[model samples]
Target: MFLPTTIEEVKKLGWKELDVILVTGDAYVDHPSFGVALIGHYLVSKGFKVGIIAQPDWKSEKDITRLGRPKLFFGISAGNVDSMVSNYTASMKKRKIDEYSSGGIAGKRPDRAVIVYSNLVRRFFPDVPIVIGGLESSLRRFVHYDWWSDRIRKSILVDAKADLLVYGMGEKTVLEIAQILSRTRDIEKCKTIRGVVWWSSKKPIDCHELPSFDEICLDKTKYAESTRLQTILTDPFKNIVLCQRQDSRYIIQNPPQLPLEQEEIDNLYLLPFERKTHPFYEKIGYVPALDMIQFSITCVRGCFGSCSFCALTQHQTTHVVSRSVDSILEEVRILTKHPDFHGIITDVGGPTANMYGSSCFVRETKGQCEKFCLHPKSCVNAKTNHERYLELLDKVRTINGIKHVFVSSGIRHDLVLNDPHGDLFIKKLIDFTPGQLKLAPEHSHPKVLALMRKPSVELFLEFKEKFEKYAKNSGKQRYVVGYFIVAHPGEGKRENEHLRKFIEEKLNYHPQQIQIFTPSPGTVSTAMYYSEIDPFTKEKVFVERSLKLRNAAKANLMSLNSAR
Candidate 1:
């Protein structure tokens, strides 16, 4: 509850002058925040005058008047709305989980339960229109099994139970809602807008489909071996299928993917972003003095790299489209001119750095490649032109006062090693520059890597060896860093032992740079974790977060690399 300075002061501020108020259910993630701010900023941009109530605990009505109770419309999120399964559970799918948990941060009021927050708001602001969106609610738009809680849960619809649910991208929908409400359209009139999920009498209705999109029907007969810009842009799956409804309901079924338009590409670069600096900076109390920043430009929209243990293909689909070098240069110039410009660029790359303005087949396809080459061991376009990326790097390096631009973005090494100029391209980096090249080998054992559908351990080793010899030859000493996951559903202590031995026998993995595996949402690994199958070995396995074992395992990678 937000306390007004005093009852007299609160009363003096004149409690009821505003037309509408917006409430959100997130405790700011401090800096380098996520999409929550995007909606808020957009609302502000439209001139609706909004107020933010940071992480209000749902149990109390005492704090509802913190802003003096003007007619309000609330926005809520399920706190990054992720689905997590316990590493220890019976049948993995036998858990029923809902409610926000404050992410276990103290002083962080338990605003973890979005349902509770909305219900409380109803009790206090009964006539208020509460709209819910964000990952949790969006993903939970329909009934589905809550693996953590093990039961069929209703759409986040009946639960946090707001007036309406805004699923999918909130940009256009939110914009329309703002316009209507700002012009004094009845709250009921909002039901007319497309893209909004609303409650009519009792059932949920996904109103209209303004712009339809095509879905890449995964079934081979329906799906092409390769996807293209127009095919995806005109996707037919405008409705998003809520949890487990028989037919596609609530979901856009088929909504448009961002098309590869020159202007849209340029627009993406203009959006605001904050760096995701490490947490330890705060622990050491050095946040204020730190100058690190994270810069990102989307290289492409979809990924067709179907590692059965993956979801990029399912969620984002696979179509490669990119921004022009000229557009990218403009953004870089903007960053460099910022008042805090420090000649050092800590990170510059995309979803995969080696894949800029590239498709599986180039010359033959006229750059309009349909499939990122589903054929062989190499990327869709390995033998084609590699000059574009090299040129991009050179242009970036020449930026006014840049000291050293680091490619912290992970690189798809398979693409790097196969490109005609692959080895030489990297050679140029060693010949002139600073930074580590990120390779996500994921796992080492051939069986395990095969399970991951990622490059083989042998492939990674070959790449590393070349990188090492290149470094030695050029007299450059920065290292080739690798990121691997452990305790996966298929990775038993024995399999993990193989990983340990492989690291020792091969490219020494390092501790400082290793990422402990956490089954993040929307990844295929999560399915395996949910099913309790290692997939490759088909053996029952546990996705363990062995802190002590992980520490030791990471030390093995670091010490071995240091010695070499």
Candidate 2:
């Protein structure tokens, strides 16, 4: 059921007051894919009267107060994507549309939506506890660089003046916090919870102290060192409390919550969601974001691929947690019964489609592995297989109401190339996937790819050859599409030239999703972009900071196939 968005809905639920009120930048879409919906629905199932205020007007208290102040606290999220990334393009220009917003209109949310909403909530209800989470807060939980402002910023908890910040996938943290606050009604007491960050008058004992906010802003080397330390401390078990001083108080981030077990994640996905935007938003028109995922499925959480530019690892952790096949099949069955059912399932994958059932056995036995599973090279301890996922796809296809099931989320080509039964897997994918398969071979230049923590281009080329051969043998004329990033930390005009040449000469295709790198917070690539040095080796790396140079790099790729 959709959480109460208006006083009328709240009344209909027979609630005179709510225990929690969630404020988000996106329209209220009661789908599992949306954090607000999942969190809201989960809270409701737990017997808390939860209300959601979606895309509230930031200019005043009118919209925020619509659902009335919560008895426990206000949960503020900047929707699915970070506000800056959602509102502005990589070029720092205002975006024309917000997929998460109703009618696909932009500017529904402010630039720093979390901070804005938190501050707004504080203004009206100064005493109420305000907790911030979601992509914007999780990524910037510590002192990090802000791309839009082109400068170092204090931890989001400090800037937003929020009482507590829930980092990572926040289900466990939020539930714990809500439970604690319900009994104690003390925000300060919620500090010890894993996956929660808060400001402290004094630093906690035996914590990892990062460089002070002022020091990181002034010293690039210190910034790099801090970034390296932060990444190392993301392990749920080994991670100690991380404290960074912002002036007088210290921002204390507790260790991340352990990755949800399979049953736990499945339960979260299985929550009773309406799977559509709240009817209140129907007047504005259907949300564009829901159109894509309404029929899609999320089979996994977390990622093994530790791409430097991606935030999946930092937020969801490098460890993978997958749902059971029966649970996934149940969701598919429900989707097929929907009135808008088209007999087509958009996707069935997670961080990386093929990494579905694969996990590091060492993590299960010991604890969080310090190094990533598939960065410098694929870890031998990491269980790399596609059989379970392939079997799941076959089961989904055989369901009574299902027709075409595409793995539209894309696969890790390297995983497919390395699998012992990869030949059969590729043939299955050729039959299951749509006309074109999506893959991200960010750059061809070895140094560039190395900085991004991606496999070498040769691996991708080998996979392409094998996939094409398999497709041809199967009488399929399918093609592979690639996602590349320009002006990434190490990529200069020279690297871009090499990338262009490789695509034309070797791959014999022009890339379509070529994007200029946007330095998002809490990412290794963003740290490198800010420090102009590789975090691993502390070696000076070429960084293209000039807007014209960045645009030129993108234009170079854009020119390809224009005249073809």
Candidate 3:
């Protein structure tokens, strides 16, 4: 059932007051992929009365105060993606539309919606506890670089004046916070909750103190140093409480909560979701983002690739957690029974499709900060196997009333290359791909790939050869689509030219769409974009600063010979 969004809906629930009110930038989508809906659904399952205020009008207190007051706290999320990144393009120009909004319209939510909503709630209900989560808060939990302003900004917790900032996959942490606050009705006492960052003037004895916000702002290198420290402390097993002084008070981030186990993840996914936008938006229009994933299933929660430009490393963490096959099949049965079932399953993957059931043997013991599992080289301990995933796909294919089970989510080609049984996996993948199999090779130039922490281009070439050989043998007319990013840090005229040449000469394909590197908050690439120095090596790196140059590089890549 959908959560109450209006006073009338709340009255239908026969509740005069709600335990929690979730405010999000995106229109309310009750799919597991949507953060606001997932959190709201989970809270309801735990017996808390929840209401949603999605895309509330930030211009006035009317929309913010429409839900009345919550008994516990106000949960604010900037939807699935960061609001600034959502509202603007990589070049910092305002975007024309938001895919998450109804009818695919723009300006539904304000820029920096988390801070905006939190401030709005604080204004109307001065003493109510405000808790912020989702990508905006998680990635901005530390003092980090801001691409829009081209400078360092304080943690979102400090800017929003939120009572608590839940970072990482926050299901466990949020539930604990809610339970504690439900009894105490105090926000300050809710500190020290795992996976949450709260403001505290008193420094704990064992906490790791990051550079002061002022120091990082004055010195770019200090900012880099703080980021390096922050990355190392992402492990849930051995992480220390991290404290960074924003102004007078310090932002104290507790140790991350361990990712949910297989059973827990299965239970979470099994929760009943309306799996569509709320009916209130019927007059407004349909959400394009919801349409894409409405028939899709998310089989995993986190990414292990840890790409330099991606924020998954911070928000979803480096740990790989997956659901049970039985649970996945159960969800598939539910999907098959859906009224809109079209005899096809859109996707059955997560951050990376092939990373399901893949993990390091010592993940619980040592932690994930040693080095990347895929980049440089696949770690010896990294279980790079596709048998389980292939098995899951095969089982789903034979289910009654399912015609085709395509993997829309992009799988890592490197992991596929590492798999000893990769040949069979590729053949099965070709049979399932709707048209073109998507691969994110990110860049073709070696120097650029190194900066992005992506695998070498040779791997991509080898994978392409294998995919073609398998596709030809299977007699299936399938294409291997590649995604590349231009103007990333360390990509200059020479690097861009090299990449373009390689795609034309070796790959023999022209990309229909190109992406300019967007340096969102709390990413290693964003830090490099701001500091002009690699965080790990502290060595100077080249950065393409001109928007014209970035756009020119993108145009050059796409203008390559179309059907070579």
Candidate 4:
């Protein structure tokens, strides 16, 4: 990159000018991921100038050219999980569509966007640098085992053309990068960031000794090549590898964080976070911000459910943790002060809807937690606490200017049933939710629920019945909808027929809000599709997901015989 020849001569830097620029594919408004507004607040608290370029029309050749360069690093993204099925022709069309047809791939190629931005700055001013972070950069850290494409793809570092690829939990990584830059350290020279996948000093760095997440699953058949997959590819793991292109084929990789102590995870998120949650922007056709900010917060990290088809515990590491209630309530008090803020607090709780102050970490050791917390099945030592959640809810509900406090996030049936307080939590949720009650009973079959590490449909229904009765006796019939997945590779016609009958018999032929399993990367179910094996029981499963059945299920859900 050419050194900026004119920055010294033409510009005087101000705090705002020196601020970091966050450009993301996801709408920055209240986004749960980047929580750009929130992150921006933290940066400002740390005294870094920050700006956001949300969902840019990168289809234009000049998209980055016009932004010029940031005196600080540029944060780039294209929404949470960059691999979106672009064209909106039909829900089923995501499969039939390719990049040419899928507008999702049309945006600025990461490498090109980063390189051009850096280069353009070099041309005019020359010495400025650009760094890329976000899902697009994180997921691209390795020559990934792409089960869908059936091959390892190039690292995103090579594609996005950024100096480095910031992977995994970026909160600490991004800050350290700025410190290095502030010390005039050549970014390319800084190779030790915990989550960095970078070019190793003129040579491709190699990590022969690094751990592989491929081992996380106890089952080997995920590689069987028979199972159809949808949605996610592997459970979240710290195993990441980076190729060094500067010289020889050197590489860098990292093992996932040792299961974090509960206190560590809690303290990590509790750090004086400046509230950056977005105020809703009433823009039409614009990407909606993640809606990260809420009247209340829950589950800072850790979920130990560890289902073969899930990554909730994998991604965050299943050691359920939470932030201090004092910090969270403080944000509500501050947000309520805004005259425009609704007297009715919007967004009460989540990150699994109600997993606050959970997780059993060993003060004695990082001791990977035992599963079945609050379960009669096994974990006699499980650390279960629904009162913590209830306490948080009560505090938020009682906060002044807050009227209706709801659990806007989908419910975790496992956790809900574990604590009687969970039942109370749901009761309060129903009584308070002015909008909708969302729950995910992902499938109807007992076997499928077991495979997904979720509760059985019967169990979900039992809970639903209880909630319904509570609401009815009290004279409230707001809706509590279940999210179901169809066409999962393991689900075949016969299994689906059974599912339909089950729904019809139990749910009165009511169709659900159907979601065709679109196996995404970074998920356990995705691996099963790639290999067609149940990592747990060594059982073989189907590999293909049924779009037709899925569509029919959805069509059935939205219609009522009375409406017809």
Candidate 5:
């Protein structure tokens, strides 16, 4: 059942007032892939009346006040993707299509949707506690660089004027907040919850202090230092509390929420999700994002790859968590029963598909390792086994009504190459994948690859050769699609030319998946983009800051096939 979006629907449920209302920047889809729905359903399961207002018209009070405000708090999210990224392109051009919106139309959500939505709610309710979360809020919880404005902005908690901010996967954090507000009705008592950030007049004792907003604004070096500190302290095992001054007030961030246990994550995915767009969007048109993921299943959570440009490490963290095989198979059975079921499961993995059931024994016992598990070199303590994931795939293919099961999520080739059972896993993956097996090599130049924290191009070449041989042996015409990024930190005209030559000679194909890098908030790449200094190495790096040059590099790569 869909959560009530209007007062009439709320009254039909015999509820006088809802305990929580979630506002999102995307159209309402009651699917687990949608953040607002997953959170709303979880809150409902905890015996609280929950409602949602999606993509509310920010200019007026109509949609914001339709549900009449909640008793506990208002939850705000900028949808699955950050709002600014959703609204604009890497070149700062306005985007024409929003997959999360009705009919793939753009302009439904404002630029900074989190801040806009929170302000709208405050204008109407005036007294309701506001809690902001999701990808946009999570990455912006600290004073970080904003590519759109090309300046350092204070923590989102300050700009949004929100009462509290929840970071990371927020299921447990939000639940705790709801329960506390229900019993005590005091927002002050919810400050110490893990995975939450709140503002205080004075800094808390024993907390790690980051550079003040003013200092970072004036000194780019200080900004880079702050990014370095935040990255190391991200380990939940460290239990580090971070504080930064934002003008007169201080923003205190508690330690991240610990990774969910196996049983906990297992039950979270099994929550009652209709897995379809709400009837409210029927007249508007189909939501493009829902169509892409309705039949797909998320078999894992979190990633350990820690790519410099990727935000998974900041939001999902480096802890790798996978759902039980039984839970995944059960969900597949349920998907087969859906009215839209077509015997095909589009995807069955998380941030990195092959990392499912993989873990680091050293970190599991001691804590986060000083080095990344898969970068530079595979750590000795890291477990690179793919046997359990292979077993799960074999069992899934035998289920009735399941015609095809594909791993559409990003696959870390380096991890597969290091795994003992990589050969068997690759053979099985090739069979499950449809026409193309997608992999992100990012770039070909060693210097650029190093800055991006991706493995060398040699690893990709090794994997591609094996993939082609296996596909030929199996009589399938499968292809390996390589994804690359242009104009990342340390990439110049020389680096771009190197990438073009490698694609033409080594890859031997026209690249279809190429992107101009966008310096989003709370990433090492973004810190480098803003400061022109590597946060880890503390050395100066070349940055392509011209928008025209960034676009030209992508155009040059895309035009390679025609030129050939």
Candidate 6:
């Protein structure tokens, strides 16, 4: 059943008032892939009356006040993707289509939707506690870089005037906040919860203090230092509290919530998701995002790959978690029985496909390592075996109504090279891929790859040879599609030319997956872009600030000869 969006629906459920109301920037789709839906369902399972108001008209009080006000709090999310990224392109151009909106229409959600929605709620309710979360709030919980305004902005919690901010995958943190508010109606009690950030007039004690907002704004070196500290201290087991002063108040961030265990994640996915777009959007048109994943299954959550440009490190954390094989197979059977079900499964993986059951024993016993697991070299403590994933795939293929099960998510090629049974895994993966496999090598030059924290291109070449050999033995016409980034930090004209020549001579095909580097908030790459200095090494780096040069580099790579 869909969550009540109007007062009539609430009355039909025999509820006088809801305990929580969720406001999102995207059209409501009651699917697990949608963050607001997943969170709403989880909250409902905990015996709380929950309602949702999606993409409310920010200019007025009509949609925002339709459900009245909740008893506990108003949960604000910017939807599946960050609002700014959803509304604009890498070139800072206004986007014309929003896949998450009704009929793929744009302009439904305002830029900085979280801040706008929070302000809208406050204008009406005036007294209700507002808690902000999701990708946009999660990454902006600190004073970080903003590419759109081309300046540093305060932590979004302060700008939104929210009572509290929940970061990371917020299932655990948000529940705690809701319970505390229900019991005492005191926002102060939620300050110590893991994965939460709140403002305080007094400075916190025994916490790692980052550079003040004024200091970071004045000194680029301090900004780089703050970014480095936040990146390395994300381990929940370490119990690290972060504090940064923004004016008279201090924003106190508690340690991240512990990564969910296998059983916990399985139960969360097994919630009674309707797996359909809400009837409210019927007249508006079909949502494009739902169509892509209606038949897909999310078999995993969280990623361990700590790429510099990727926000998964901040939003999902570096802890890899997977659902049980039984749980996944059960979901697959359910998908087969859906009204829109066909024989084909579009995808069955998470952030990285092949890292389904991967883990690090040392980190489990100790804490996060200073070095990344698969960056410069694979860590000795890391387990790179793919046996469990291969077993799951083999079992899934035997289901009664299943025809084709595809692994559509991008796989970390470095992990595949390190796995003992990688060759067999590659042979199996070919049967599922729809003619093209997605691989992100990022760049061909070593200096550029180092700045991006990706593995060397030599590893990519080695994996390409093995993939071709396997495809030939299976007698299938398959190809390896590469994703690259142009105009990233440390990429000068010489580096760009080197990558272009390598793409022409080595891959010998026109690349369609190239993107210009976008300096989003809370990423090491963005720190380098703003500071023009590498955070880890403290060395000066070259940054292309001109919009024309960045576009020219991408065009140069795209116009390569397809001599395959």
TM-score (all chains, Cα) for each model: 0.67, 0.98, 0.98, 0.75, 0.99, 0.98
Report, for all candidates in order, the number of backbone clashes.
38, 0, 0, 62, 0, 0
RMSD of each: 8.5, 1.2, 1.3, 6.9, 1.0, 1.3
Query: What would the per-residue lDDT of candidate 5 be over residues 375-449, giving only the tens digit for each residue?
Result: 797777767658888788878878999998888899888888887778887888887888899899999999999
The superposed Cα distance between candidate 4 and the true structure at residue 375, in angstroms, equals: 9.9
Residue 77 C-alpha lDDT in model 1: 59
Q: Which ranges of candidate 2 are over 4 A from the true structure?
A: none
Please say which candidate is ahead in lDDT: 1 or 5: 5
Give the worst 10-residue stretch by lDDT in candidate 4.
1-10
lDDT of 1 by residue, 1-564 (tens): 121222453455454344334444434322222345455545544545444455565557655556554444666655443423222123233233222222333333342245766787778877777777665565454433354453334556667767666655565566667677667745677765655555433223533322111222222111121121122232223323211222333332223223346565455445544332223223423222123334434444444455544434433344455667887778788768656567766555555666666655342233323333331265545443456877777787798977766665566777777776788876765633454666778887765665566777777788888887889886778567667766555666677778777766665544455544545333445445544553333555455545466556555555665676
Query: Which 10-residue window of candidate 3 scores lowest in summed lDDT?
Result: 555-564
Better of 1 and 2 by lDDT: 2
- The residue-by-residue lDDT of candidate 2 on 1-564, one tens digit each, is 778888999999888999999999999998998999999888887878899999988888899989887989999999999999999888778899999989999889998899999999999999999999999999999888888888888988888988899988999889988999999999878988999988878888889899998898779878888888888777786767888988898988888898888888888888888888888877889999888788888998877687889998788777788899999999998888787888999889877888898877677655556676777787788787688999999999999999899888867787777778988898888877688887888999999999999999998888888788888887889887788999998887789999989888887667688899999899999989999999988899999888888988988987887945
Choose 5 or 6, whichever is better by TM-score.
5
lDDT per residue as tens, model 3, 156-247: 99889888999988888889888998889888777868898888777778899999899998998888788778887777877788899888
lDDT-wise, the better of 2 and 5 is 5
lDDT of each: 0.51, 0.87, 0.87, 0.51, 0.91, 0.89
Best by TM-score: 5
* Candidate 2: residue 244 Cα off by (Å): 1.2
Report the lDDT tens digits of candidate 4 across residue range 1-564.
010112331143333244466665444444233444445544554656556555445445344444455665766554454444232212434333223111322342332233333344345444555566555455445433344344444555665555665655555667667777767657764466655655554433443322122422333453332122111221123233333232244335343334344454444444444233223223233232323243344445545555554534334445454667776676567667755456655555545656566555451134443333432232544455666766777788788887766666555666677665666766766766664566777777766766676666767787777777778877888666677776665776666666666666676335546666655444557656665676435687776544466566555544544453
Q: Tell me the lDDT of model 2 at 525.
A: 94
